[model samples]
Target: MTTLQNEPAACAHAELAQLRIRVIALENLVISLLADTSERQLAIARDMATYISPRPGFTPHRPTVHAAAQIIHLVGRARHFRPMAPSRRSR
Candidate 1:
């Protein structure tokens, strides 16, 4: 009886875990694509993150706010993959 009651909860937990894995995979793909894109496109993506960010003192849904922050953080990570600029001394 207790096992039957816990079964649904276990299923739900498993589904949630799968969803999290998918989200992480998607984030990594986006980071890779962004890293390969032009600087102008990357800047546009950064602007989009800023655009979606919640304003001060405004109550936005938690997930929405989190997504915005994730986008910005992903962009930062993508930036790290970009090639380093040539030093002035090398020019």
Candidate 2:
């Protein structure tokens, strides 16, 4: 072919090559972003799971002395009350 024809063809080929390279780079960038998003989601899921999991031990609702006194008082009150008649126990 003549130089004029060859020049245009070469320019078109170069442009097509550059476009292919850009498209490949864009695809790689998109894939990388998706992977990053997936990693972030997994980390969030793990954090939420940890947050929702039950703890190992119990917690007191009141101070130690007050709670102990309340328990003793209730037990003493229970002992003072009697439900059965004397005859039932004698039988």
Candidate 3:
């Protein structure tokens, strides 16, 4: 007679256990998803860094001081040869 009266309480306990199992499964799924997202974000960051970074073996072109001076001299010579306009007449 007591077992028959406790039968409804036992069913309620079983339902509660099932709900707990489902919640644990959902938590596991969320953790896995977060880990995957973190990995993908790291990969994308590395790819973007590769695109923006200069190559290891690249050597930039730098003009020597002598070459720069030569260019300046040439420009000066051209300026010296340019025709000068007549001086402005005073009013």
Q: Highest lDDT: which candidate?
A: 1
Q: Poorest 10 consecutive residues of model 2 by lDDT?
A: 73-82
Instruction: Flag clash pairs in model 3.
Output: none
Compare the candidates by TM-score and give the number of the best one. Answer: 1
| lDDT (Cα, tens digit) per residue for candidate 3, span 39-86 | 455445345544544456875234433444433343443443444446
Q: What local distance difference test score does each model get?
A: 0.86, 0.54, 0.54
Backbone clashes under 3 angstroms, per model? 0, 0, 0
How would you order the candidates by lDDT, starting with the best? 1, 2, 3
After aligning candidate 3 to the native by TM-score, how far in Å is the CA of 53 from where it should be?
41
> After superposition, which runs of candidate 2 have C-alpha atoms over 4 Å from their true positions?
38-91
Measured on C-alpha atoms, candidate 1 has an lDDT of 0.86
Residue-wise C-alpha lDDT for candidate 1, range 9-82, written one tens digit per residue: 99999999999999989989998998888989988887887788788888887888788888889988998787
Candidate no. 2 TM-score = 0.40
Instruction: Score candidate 3 by TM-score against the native.
Output: 0.38
What tens digits encode model 2's per-residue C-alpha lDDT throughout 33-60?
4344444554554454445444457454
Residue 91, candidate 1: C-alpha displacement in angstroms: 12
